[model samples]
Target chain A: MDEKTRRQALKAATLGAAAALASPVAAQMGGSKAQPGGKQDPRSKYPKPPFKSQSQPWPGLASKMNPRPDHGDTSYVGSGRLTGRKALITGGDSGMGRAAAIAFAREGADVAINYLPEEEPDAREVVELIRQAGRKAVALPGDIRTAAFCKDLVAKALAGLGGLDILVCNAARQQSIPSILDVTDEEFDRTMKTNIYAPFWIIRAAVPHLDPGSAIIGTASEQAYNPDGDLYAYAQTKAATMNYVKSLAKQLGPKGIRVNGVAPGPIWTPLQVSGGASQGKLVTFGATAPLGRPGQPAELAGIYVRLAEDDGSYTTGNIYGAGGGQGQP
Target chain B: MRLPLRVLTAGGAALALVAPAFAQGPGSQRTREFVSASAQSDQFEIDEAVTALAQSENPDVRGFATRMIEDHRKTSQALADAVSRSKLAAPPPGIGGDQSMFLSALQSARGSEFDRLYARQQVLAHHAALVTVEVYAASGDDPNLRAVAADTSALIQSHSAMADQLAAKMEEGQARP
Candidate 1:
């Protein structure tokens, strides 16, 4: 790690965020055009995917598709909700991870993200966004399949960012199977290790660095409560994740670390396109959501910021449903 | 393996864009000679990935470098074994001109720039190698090299996939906020 380069990147990132957060001196506070006021249908933004099916090999590429999933690259406008905080988000390369990271940096937190070693390109882009927000950004890649890597994931962020205040276990892998009989031992284990095991490993590693005001947010899914027949393994892991949040919250409450989970309904992420869901599933993805469309990643950023903030004091152990009126617990 | 190469593949465009370069595959002599050069390129990437492991703060790139070292070594050995199994003459040492150009440029890069350049090079080199092996696998005069190409093409294609993913993510950072 070049200390000078790291420092420069951080400095550059902070300046970038500062510029985005910078308000025009002449602007009024009541309600500008920047703030949408009247009737607006959130569902009307981006068009849904058509009947076509797509897949990229493992490690999943988000850029190859024709519609290209919207990662909040331009839509998310940040308020200074998490200034100077330090955050480490696993899977921060794309989808929810990327969206949360962009929001965190814009809110003034120095951010570090982790992803699969193969997702470095996406991670680098997130790092650039953080640095653009003028916040320090670092991207780490690793498989959370092992305890050692999970420990190191936190360790690296602590070492790189100088501390850790927010730990978001948002990276997960799901390979949908038609029947329980269709599940291989390895496949079941990978789903468990990535979704359930890794969160435990990461939370355990991140605990020591967290203070009373610190937040640890894990991503659960709408499937936790209302799972489809084909997603037994994934649903089981998510349910476990939700339960784990409650258990950890009970354990960590005395220590001041707020543990929570976010359960997204159908949102357009590489997960669906990358075999987490079937090709048939991708076509109707969020169609069942009450909103009648899949949620965008940008839609989840506010809840993430809220949970990670120092003053988000009232919330803990509870799962926030950012689902488009989908299942909730 | 430099800027434009990385740029081309960042969006999963590597296979489509570089497919043409290997459409005819290299000539028979070049196909026979490719193993030595490909092995050298692996060494080149290993050397570069090692540098990333040591210097990159980004875990993603560091982890990728580790994979590069591990996977390339295994494939290199596989190729060497394939060569030994057949009557093909031993390839000369040290790498070809284009690979050297890539390595020299990689040697000079640092920080995120280094990560970017490294991933780009990996994407280019792997795709080219895939094309080379594929060309030979599909049409080589040497039965042995063709078998080796057939054996190695899958791994090379996978490497290209991994590199393509890496390049894709790195491109996200390039977008002006």
Candidate 2:
């Protein structure tokens, strides 16, 4: 499509998403109603596929996404599950990291979030949400693709939050290409640094400060188990993330620290619009899942909470899956 | 690691350890007691560490005192966070009556005497703290405060073990003379 036509199509899709937000189905199926004792049809709880095909520069902002993704700004309620704990979450400006930050704050943790400098706008929203939840919010913006920045990020979080007990290595880099031949050396290196090296550095820096009962959570993906041909580098890094979670759990468990990973299927976030998915794939995102929809970031907030809380004491070295019923587990 | 909130059943040893300081009571009263006691304990630890930093010349004693200040501050902040989350109100953290008495004794000590006293005091303080937190973690009314207790108990246990080591080493050093 031509540039002009593409822009118009983007505008049309945004309007459609806005219209769908107000539809009777969405109005009746309120997101907040899925409380502890409440029940609702899971399949229709959130938006479905045929999403708007949108594009943004690298490291997109969640605020720009059509039908803005929910990071538990309203739906999640905390009962002090993580009260007094301190956490450092990467990519916390959007996606699963944002969801976890909101939940952690509500659960009574002082939170420090790291994101790319471009995501300051989205990070601002998250900082506000955490403060509203009556918890400390520390925003550290830097590129995780560099080892120096990754190390500094952890240090700043430790200093800002005073100490670290929960570390969520949820930030990643994903850019879809038709073939391995199309993947440039720089692109491959960028993916490796962001997905793998960053976590390695951050965890190394953080493990020493984590006392007993500390938790380290890495965000794996469904792509790790079922790799997409185009996402070769990104998929392998997730596999590495899954592998390290098990390995580190064994290494840290004896020291009273728990390590776990979250494998999310097709979750709607800034990733889809910011070159993580091909434009062609964006419209039909999550369409192939059994639920026929993309899981919002809010849907998986509880999984992160469970992994970080003390109640999941015996649940280390495990991968918790949220794949919209596609059976990634 | 943190103990589960509801699943932890206190055994005979745990009850024996807690019996001297705490009396069996209703859940709400127990929670109130835990919160107030925790705040007081944390305050005492911080104040004691500050005094040690000023008085003690031995590297090990000063190092342990520095760690106590940092770790106790975190726990104190956690207690404050729990208090804000619950309906209960906590007084500003201050040393307990017994802690004040202990501090008075430690303040007058000099040189090696100060280090030995600090170690001994740490053993007593952390043992008491361990008992208080373990009891609350085993069965506390508020889920939030129970979590704080569970998390704090792990640190206190570590501190107690360290204190035991320090006290033994200090006594051995004094015996050498």
Candidate 3:
């Protein structure tokens, strides 16, 4: 339908869902009842905010998240794409990594998740989800920015899964500097090391054992293109990541390995709540994208699945832009 | 490629429609169908890729394919209701011809051969997808479809940039003794 009609239809559907949830009869029939301000209770079918601000730097695990970051668990379906494969994903405690991990497990791939030590609780929950999906899950706690840690991580994956088929260099750190002049050297270095250099280190360490047909997918960003003034350093790092993926793709192509990247626009993930931006700023996300709303994690899961499976066999050394049209180019 | 004249003319007309903010009437079902059909076509490409990756034996290809499937599926579903309302036919399958041959080669091969074939295809696919999204966005009648097309076009551009970088890197790697 046209934009206007589509919008109207979406609005109508949303209202219908809300109304269905609000009716007492519907509630009696197992539907959730709406609370004040059109909000659902925290325990309701629709997530309710436990606190006024659900955006914290460390929102912790999905289970513990107050209102919870929407990861689209109910909507995602696995088609056995990664059956019998094994993967290692950094920052798998929550957000995009966690969503990817869940989808991977559902697809029959065993997973090894690495998270910061402080994020143990969140890591545990993701591990449980993997196990529940009947897939093996190894939770490794360490800092990925260190080369030593990266090496150890590879060793652990080898020991845990016997072999690794996929390496998702997806962890990242972001802090808004408002302007180039305001960017501190420490901040710039930290962002670069976390978002760019860390991936480089991990890939280097993992390369030795990666067999032909193994894949490496990096999590870049929409900021790599249409960067905002405030995210100069973060954007620069993400842009560098895309180049890194490109270079890696070519260097590894000879070895029968494929390298790629995913540049997500404004998807509501833990990164948005805790990475460094204020909650107020994040609430306006997706407004600027053509879709006019922030994307949920569930929305991103399918793309991750597509890239990690053979469906994209003819795809490599490429970047898939999942942004809501914010950085189309 | 230069912008199509049709887009430029359509853009002018759209601009006229936008001036008064509410002057123009809502789009017709046919217009909506056209836009929806265009979006469905993009989704179908993604779905096809997902289906292929799910059954792939190569881990690298499989991993990348998995992500594409997950992301594109969500986007496809997000547009489903709208596309359904329009009742338009989906875009023709696979962009066809030599591109199909190249894709098949990558899927069936392994090792260095696979990589080379895949890299070449990445460039071609992104370029083609970019053109498709751009033209549809600029000239399509449905505002939402145009918006989605424009958004996807930007993404394809990023892919193109990434492809260029990959091509150069592959060239450099090949040059090494």
Among these predictions, the greatest lDDT belongs to 2
Docking class of 2: incorrect
TM-score of 2: 0.60
Off by over 4 Å in 2: A1-30, A33-36, B1-177
Task: List, residue by residue over B29-114, the lDDT tens digit for candidate 1.
Answer: 66566766667766656655655654466777877878888987887777777667764555543445566446435543455666
What's the TM-score of each model vs. the native? Answer: 0.59, 0.60, 0.56
Best by TM-score: 2
Measured over the true interface residues after superposition, the C-alpha RMSD of each candidate is 22.6, 31.0, 19.9
Q: Arrange candidates, best lDDT first.
A: 2, 1, 3
For model 1, residues A190-278, the per-residue Cα lDDT tens digits are: 98899988988988888887877899999999789877666888888999989988998999889988999999987787787787765
TM-score of chain B of each: 0.75, 0.83, 0.58
Give per-model CA RMSD: 22.4, 26.1, 21.2
What are the Cα lDDT values of the candidates? 0.74, 0.81, 0.64
lDDT tens string, model 2, A295-317? 88988999999999999999999
I-RMSD for candidate 3: 19.9
Writing each residue's lDDT as its tens digit, candidate 3 over A156-226 gives 98899889989998888887445467678887887888888788888898899988878898888877876
Q: What would the DockQ be for model 3?
A: 0.01
Candidate 1 RMSD to the real structure: 22.4
